[model samples]
Target: MAKPKAKLETLQDKEILTSELAAIVGKTPQWIRQLTRDKVLNQVSRGKYNLGEAVQAYCEHVSGGKEEEQKPRLIDFKTRYEKTKAEKAELELERIKGNLHAAADVEWLLSDMILTIKTRLLGVPSRVSTECENESADVVESVVRREIETALSAMAKYTPDQIGGDVSHGGPEDS
Candidate 1:
């Protein structure tokens, strides 16, 4: 039988001096003192130190595992979506207000045109044609009215399930 190998003893209370550590690390003792002064290495007892713990701490520092170098947590897409939706809602509200103002102007223009037509029809030279010579205004007004009707029809078309409401609505296309 082969002779039993000698068991190695664990070093629990073993320590090294600052000069010894500097010699092992191939640095000056003054540099070790600077490390201690910078709090990179804690002084356990005067100049004596735990070389194992110091090496481990130095390794961690050089490897960039220091607490201050941790990455910040990132925000997820759902939060970004909610933020964008809120901004879109604000913009939509402004757009609706502007549309309301424009609708008021259109109503005023249409009212004024109807009043002029009524007055002209009531009292005008028989030879003079009261009918508008320019069809562009009528065409524009008709186009606007058609677009508004189409939008309203689109809104009306949504069923309760589609609109998240109670009534079953049909669009012009459905009709």
Candidate 2:
């Protein structure tokens, strides 16, 4: 017995399967599936796409043109993203460590400076008494107060940063 021939339908706007479209476009079925998933090719129905529209969309995509709804590529954060996050965290830790070291050095400098100032202040009256050996107690008191005020005023004129350098920036030699 002879098999009957398949009838050819003359539908104008016929839709085709992704595999059929892929064959027509000379591309793989996977490529066509990707295009559909990317929304580059408009699917008319589930697992079916308008052949004419798909061809037009594919041509536009190939020519660097986009449709009304531009699909953004989804980013996967499990690979390079995790590595970048770790790098940023390490850089932040190093920066914090450097700042801590700078803070410690500044604290040491400030304490040393304060100790020197206090020593000078404590010795001021004795030094003044030697300068005015024969002066009255009242005279000595007045001179000490005036000298202390003048020294404090001079010290007040300098800012903390200005007073903070040691041998490196030519301020004072650190022992």
Indicate which candidate wins on lDDT: 2
* Alpha-carbon local distance difference test for all models: 0.59, 0.71
Superposition error at 135 for model 2 (Å) = 1.9
RMSD, one per candidate, in order: 17.3, 11.7
Per-residue lDDT for 20-137 in model 1, tens only?
Answer: 8789778899998998898877777999888678777666645544645354222334567789999988877866665323344444444444554555444433312233244577
Lowest-scoring 10 consecutive residues by lDDT in candidate 1?
Answer: 163-172
TM-score, every prediction: 0.32, 0.35
